[model samples]
Target chain A: METKGYLDMDLLRFTTAGSVDDGKSTLIGRLMYDTKSIFEDQLEAIERSSEKRGDETVNLALLTDGLKAEREQGITIDVAYRYFATPKRKFIIADTPGHIQYTRNMVTGASTANLAIILIDARNGIIEQTSRHTFIASMLGIKHIVVCVNKMDLVDFSEEVFSAIKKKYQEFSSTLNLADIQYIPISALKGDNVVDASKNMDWYTGKTLLQTLESVQIISDYNFEDARFPVQRVIRPQSAQYPDFRGFAGRVEGGVFRPGDSITVLPSGLTTKISKIYNADVELQEAYSPMSVCITLENNIDISRGDMLVKSDNLPNVEQEVELMVCWMNDKKMNPTGKYLLRHTTNEAKCVVKNIAYKMNINTLEKIVDNFEVEKNDIVKITLKSAKPLFFDSYKRNRGTGSVILVDEFSNETVGAGMIV
Target chain B: MSYNLNHLEQLEAEAIFIFREAVEQFENPVILFSGGKDSITLVHLAYKAFFPAKIPFPLLHIDTGHNFPETLIFRDELAKRYGVKLDVGYVQDSINRGTAVEEKGLNPSRNTLQSITLLEKLEEGKYDAAFGGGRRDEEKARAKERFFSHRDEFGQWDPKNQRPELWNLFNGKKAPGESFRVFPISNWTEMDVWQYIKKENIALPSIYFAHDRNIVNRGGVLLAESPYNTLLPGEKYEQMHIRYRTLGCMTITGAIFSDADNLDKVIEEVAAARSTERGNRADDKRSEAAMEDRKKQGYF
Candidate 1:
């Protein structure tokens, strides 16, 4: 493998979501093994574990079931991050658990993923888990989805079986707002069409699973129209050398910014001009989304943490009362008009539940209106009134500026993850 | 506009964002330094996170009292170069104070005993957050760790009861007595760390490069000779030109025989290497659940 120009390679982060026996772990194992990402020691360790468990063949699932309880029960309880790199792009797989009880873990994993791989067992076709995971993936603002029809070997690698599963999945996914969807048939255990092309199913001509992952166009995933920078800290060097240095430190959440751009600080409604944008001691000509840089405004203003810097005219909605679709994460059910802390970007406020709009029946994508009792792993749409106004857009507009996590006051556990409507 | 960041830039950007979040969330924070490459990379990112301004947090080293001599000098120089405070918590001090009992064995390692000293120092300093150089790819137990990992009042990690972290928005809220062990580079792998070190031209300890050291082979793992470890019968230190893959208490860390003395050669060696970096760690070799057990007891 050539190491030259390896520094110029980009990164792609995706997640895998499915039921317990959908061969998610085995698929990941095949990908890593084919790409030579699994080290010899790790394979040896898992081989030893497989033998100790009295398995006939090496259990690839043991690679991700890292926790003691998980290993004992032979199930993945939490999100296990796996890494691999092709010659073109590096990949980060947020392998989330797929049990219904673990839906919250799936939501957590999909929040930062650019794409989501939803596995389908060919024998079972599109099950409830297939739709439930798809709903969560689309709800979390993931634009790309790859439906991997796994276990083709179990189905005798029939072309009719693959097409039927794809058609039904497409009909079910029509309700979601996913941008791009692709289908591939493969058997994770038999290494069919995972890394290399499969000869077993020559009738279906398509890119392999690894090819789809490596060739996915993810450059247009981030929102680049509205410039939003929420200040996390104010860097001020008090020393004698360049004593008057004051810059706003933040990661650009959306759009682009350059020196002399007219910027407005949210909640304060103060306006200033960008004098310089410093990316850690080195000044840059332009800064875009996801780059952590310090911005120096022309006028010294009272801009502090929780203050957002955006384009003067292209402003986000500043509202005290907001509607959100939240995935309940904790066992402690949400109370009526419950007071919880809401964190958005760099700012946070004490927010009360104004109203519960509806709860989603994840399996059928139906709205349950009458019963408002929310439990863990339930997706509910609710309205919130915060202590202060939050500058934001709809979740579909920009994921970075449009997401919030609700923290329980007494327990301090992240109880709900929300996206603005 | 491309709106694209290379893998290195992307990792750097994510780490810097996390660093600033800790600065804004916690009242008092410190970087848990070990004079290793990971901590060294952490320090470099923190410096860039708050450029033009001095690093806001101090460096806290839980000294095992058995360290590479080169690491000691490098740690002091790094502290001075960054103009940050260096706070050392000595395991020997904990042992002398009777708070921690040292192990009595043929090959006694201070690795597990450092937890007692670490918790004591965190309590003594009343630090609300301790930034560590923990990467998920390093160990299996760490693979599912949260970026802002919470510790109880006793500084014990409850792996099963961790809060769900979503997106870049980290929930750092905690009770009054509880503290957090935050890992900014939890997503980076071992290869990413080495590549970043080379890309940024970051300085590391001399032990990381190829050097001649007197080491003894124990169960196929070569351990460098130090006063902290005693040799078994028929065991003698042999001169070998080897380099350390990881740095810890000199008694536990193992070395590999290689001639990769420079950055390019080191990256090349790491690329074609077959074993995990922590495969040589005696502490992890104790059991499959060793890292998890140690993490539960407040080990970094």
Candidate 2:
């Protein structure tokens, strides 16, 4: 294997959603095998286990269904993360189950992904689970969607089948906010059009799945127009050496920040100039989204965790009352008037659900105005009254600053995930 | 155009962010130091996270009383070099107090006893958060572990009931008497760890490099002959060149035959290696779900 681009390779995190028998694990296993990511020992272990279980073919699903219960039950209970890398890029696959009851797992997996791969069985074109997965991906602000129409071998590698499924999916997803969508007809079981172009289906002219993933333009996926930095910690070295060093440390959520840029600290509304941006000891002229750094300001303002810094010219909405589309994740039903802990970008506030506007029919993309009770797996738009004002934007405008998690105050469990409207 | 971090730098920043979060959230936190490459890399990251100022938390080493002498020396030297407090939880103490019983067999290892000592130390010290060097790619059971893994009052991990970790927002909340096991490098792989160590020039134990050592082959694994390891009948020691891929109690940790003595060679060897790092570990060879069973019992 070539090692020239090993040092400069970028990282891409993608999520996979598929029900049982969709060959999700097989596709992943094929990718690993083609990329030489699977070790000999792991392959041998899986082979031995597969033989013991009386599987005629080596069950690649056993490689991912790692837990005892999961292997015994033949289902993925939780999201299992798998890593593989080619010379071009390093990939992290958040393998999530596609069952309706595991919607929260999909959400968790897709939350940090750059792309979403929705697997569709060619035999069953555009099922309910396909729409459900696509809707959740769109809700999570994933821009790229790779619709893998798998099991093409069973469909005789027919172009009509692939095109039909693609057209149906495109029609349904035309209303979604997906930016880049691509279709690939693959046989995860037969190694066709996955890592290499298929010899069977010469009608497909586009790149293979691996080629598309390796060459996708993900650098511009982040929002670089509005600068937002939520301070996670205040670095103050109170020691004898350089006692006056006080820096606000945080990961840049959006846009570009540079030295001498006039910024406004939210909530306090204090304006200051950034003197230096340090990415771990080395001072750089500029920093952008997803890069964690500490910035030293011209003034020693009263700044701590939960306070956001934005460009003076560009500001976010500061308000105490906000509307959000929330996905209830806990088993307990959401109480409309109950208090919860609302955490957004390092800031935590006590909030209460003022009213449930409507619940979303995820499959049909319809709003049920009559149903007000928000149960598990229900996506509802509700109004929240927070104890303190929050700095935010719409989830569409900025995913980093516009997302929040609701923690049940009594149990301290995260019960709901919300995207600010 | 904006500046973007490469893979290693991105991983470093993420680990640092996690460390800062743990310090900000938990009142009492400690880093679990086993003097392995992963833990050594964690210490280096922690030191960088709060640079110029000492690490906010102390370093806790659950000594199994069967560790490589080089590992102990390196651990103490690292703690002193970083100017951080070091706390030792001895497995021998647990055994003497009758809190832990030793396994009666030819290959009895104190590896499992360290769990009891670690939990007892945590309860005694009232540590609310413990930093472990666990990576998701290490074992199957560890793949489902959260960055902020919650432990019940009895110090058990319920894999099915873990909190949904979304984006970088880790839910570290737990009930009273409960604590969290924070894995800052949970996303890093074994190859990534070695690359980071090579880039950062992090010091490790000499046992990691290939050297001539007396070993006995047991169950197709090379076990370093030590006073702790009792050789079975028909087993004889042989001198061979070997290096440890992982570090644990001397009895359970196995060394693989290799000649990758330096960082560059080690990286190349790792890239071309055919087995997972834990393939040679006897403890994991106990059963298919050995890691899971141990983790359910609160074994780090």
Winning candidate number (lDDT): 1
Candidate 2 chain A: worst 10 consecutive residues by lDDT?
A1-10
TM-score of predicted structure 1: 0.99
> What are the DockQ scores of the candidates, in order?
0.81, 0.67
Candidate 2 C-alpha error for residue A75, in Å: 0.7
Give one digit per residue, the lDDT tens place, for model 2 in A163-241.
Answer: 9999898899999978899999999888899998999999999999999899887888889989999998888878898
Candidate 1 Cα deviation (angstroms), residue A78: 0.9
Tens-place lDDT per residue, model 2, B1-300, is 546567777788889889988888899999999999999999999887776566889999999889899999999999999889999999999999999999998778888888899999999999999999999999999989999999999899999999888877867787899999999998898878988998888998999999999999888888888889888899999999999989988898889999999988888888888899998888887788999999999999
- Model 2 per-residue lDDT at B110: 89
Q: After aligning candidate 2 to the native by TM-score, how far in Å is the CA of B236 from where it should be? A: 2.0
Backbone clashes in model 1, listed as residue pairs: none
| Tens-digit lDDT string for candidate 1 (B15-113) | 999999999999999999999999999999999999999999899999998899899999999999999999999999999999998888776788888
Candidate 2 backbone collisions, by pair: none
lDDT of each: 0.92, 0.90
